[model samples]
Target: MERFVNWSGSLAFDAERLRQPTSEQEVIDIVHEALDRGGSVRPVGSGHSSTPLAETGDTLISFGRMAGLVGADKSNGRATLLPGTGLAEAGSALAEHGLAMENLGDVDYQSLAGAMGTGTHGTGRELGNLSSTLVGGTLVTGTGAVVRFGEQADSAQGQTLLRAAQLALGALGVLTSLTLRVQPAFDLHRQNWMTHIDWVLGHFEELSQTCRHVDFYWYPRSDRAQVRVLTLPGDEPAISPPGYLKKDERGPSYEVIPNFRDLKFDEMEYMLPLEHGLEAFRRVRERVKDRHRDKVGWRVLVRTVAPDDAMLSNIRQPTMTIALLQNASLDHEPYFRDMEALFLDWGGRPHWGKKHYRTAPDLRRMYPDWDAFLTLREKCDPEGVFLNDYLTEIFGLQGAP
Candidate 1:
């Protein structure tokens, strides 16, 4: 019984039965049997989600054994993959055929289904999340029936299936296979640096215009911050960091925090008009320094994306996301409160897969089509078999009987 947790350095759930069903029929049988006994069933992938969406007492299914590149449509520039395939592996396999995903997240270990379930995304003002690349997929519902949907001429059905697949979140059912649209291979010319916070804020618009991919991360408790800017070939190029430095990991520095939830931190993030990104980040930095007396670390990362239409994506519009990472040994609640207040003032929306304390009421204010999303969830998962404390608390989902 091997058990694992998410990559955020938070949350773990030990299941009574952890089964790796190798075939579709086996998965169907497992779900049906769980229902027959009046129990719940949940499927887990790489456990990369920060939230405990996969927690279940009855049965836990892992898709690792059911992974591989099942088929490819080279002429149409598409590929059919098993749900358990790793994003990195999929990217590499597609390269062999002179094809590639439109974009990818920072880490590549996530399975196709798990990443799509939580709307794992990359950077690009016009590009949506990875799930947007999905042209079609096969979802095995709780009742053990496989339903395939995507690319219907009927606008309503196409839009419905598109939203359903964008952030399945394991509530809908087990995803068995995925078919994704691919693009011709491309390369990135990456730049890196440590710079003043003020300079970033003032020049964000110009920066976004200059770069193909732009993103930044801030380290709380430090005056200095790292910055990254990437561009495609034939773009106006300037000085970039030493090639070696640009390859560095740009997230939080490792620390031995026993309880990640209790760690004190503050963050302000927003999906800014791509042109306003540099200045938006700069404003956030200025605010943090003035408000917190404790030492803080600072950094900024930037990346690029092609294009897609996933509803849950931050890059649905041309967006520049600024993530502020704070470090401290105090309680996290108060800092989050202050941070959220500021984010609201600045019109920021929370990232779906990251840690944030916004309630449904607050979320309603942030999202315009929140009710529509709720309606979609109800239609696919009427029973709410996948509802958990996190989903209910954040999205206000009433657990299905």
Candidate 2:
């Protein structure tokens, strides 16, 4: 048996079989085999997800062999990529064609399919998560059939499938290819500075509204925060007080948007309504300062995401995401659970790819189209070929093998 470990080493499992399929036909054959054997299959990407979304005891499929830019349409600003293409790889590939993703998350190590499937996002008041850029794709459904959705879908049912597939957490099917909305290559000016957490809380709205990208990291021990804002080269300058500048630079959007993350950490993030975001953050800050300050040596991160219609997307409206990150070697459950209560009280939805305790009952209330997604999932993977114990439990799938 081969043991599979995630990026943070937070989740690991010994799989009975681990295979990397180099082509879509191979992926289809693997699925068909799994179905024939009454076994399950799970897709593993860069393993960036903190949750056990890709865990499976039966078979694990790695898409590393199936990565690259398949097509580029400079005229339409669209690019088709393989499921295993890394975000960084995609950025470079698109840049070669004078195109770039509209936005990107801080870390670019995740595979394009995994990022879109998990609704990974970058910070911007108007930009939606990466999933929102998913215009079309092909996935091998649980029934061992290849289905085209998104722009390729010609019917209302196909569109509905696209919505369900947008952020299905790998439970819906094995995504083999993804088409994303791209833009002509551009550059951005990035600025970073240290400030009091209070200042950030006070002017967060203004910063978020004016900057193309704005996020902050709150350090509990010092009651201070580090703010980062990115804007187009000629856009209005970020408001920063004297002597607060930490970094000022300009680069291509691909280079400027993502930051290298060397430290390994376990993260739990929740998306809360923008209206209650500040208040929730205030309460979380107070509680962390009072209760977990002694054990916590990490910072709390805050960012915003625009809403999209992905059925299970965390941001249903303008959303503020609060992420608690603890050193991977340290115990994070107590602190994470404590903050999760605060988030849930404020109608927060857990990031599907991150750590959370929410189950089907809690999730049903958070998503208006929960049942519809569930129905589609069942329709696609009736045999539960793509489901593992973790997914089965969270989805409340009854009698799943």
Q: How close is candidate 2 to the true structure, as a TM-score?
A: 0.98
- C-alpha lDDT score of every prediction, in listed order: 0.64, 0.90
**Residue 398 lDDT, candidate 2, scale 0-100:** 65
Give one digit per residue, the lDDT tens place, for model 1 in 1-401: 44556554455666778888888999888877876776777778787665577877668888999898887767888888888998877877777777777767756778988888877777655556687888877777766677676852246675666666667677777888888888776666655566654444455446656675555545555554455665664563464432234342221111100012434333334455555545555566667668753644433343334444554554455556655544433344455556556555656666666556678888776666567777766665556555666677778765545
Residues 236-304, candidate 2: write the lDDT tens digits. 554764338888889989888999899999999999998888899999999999999999979999999
Go through the candidates in order and give the C-alpha RMSD of each one to the true structure.
5.6, 1.1
| Stretches of model 1 off by over 4 angstroms after superposition | 1-4, 152-159, 219-222, 234-236, 240-279, 293-316, 326-333
Per TM-score, the best of the predicted structures is 2
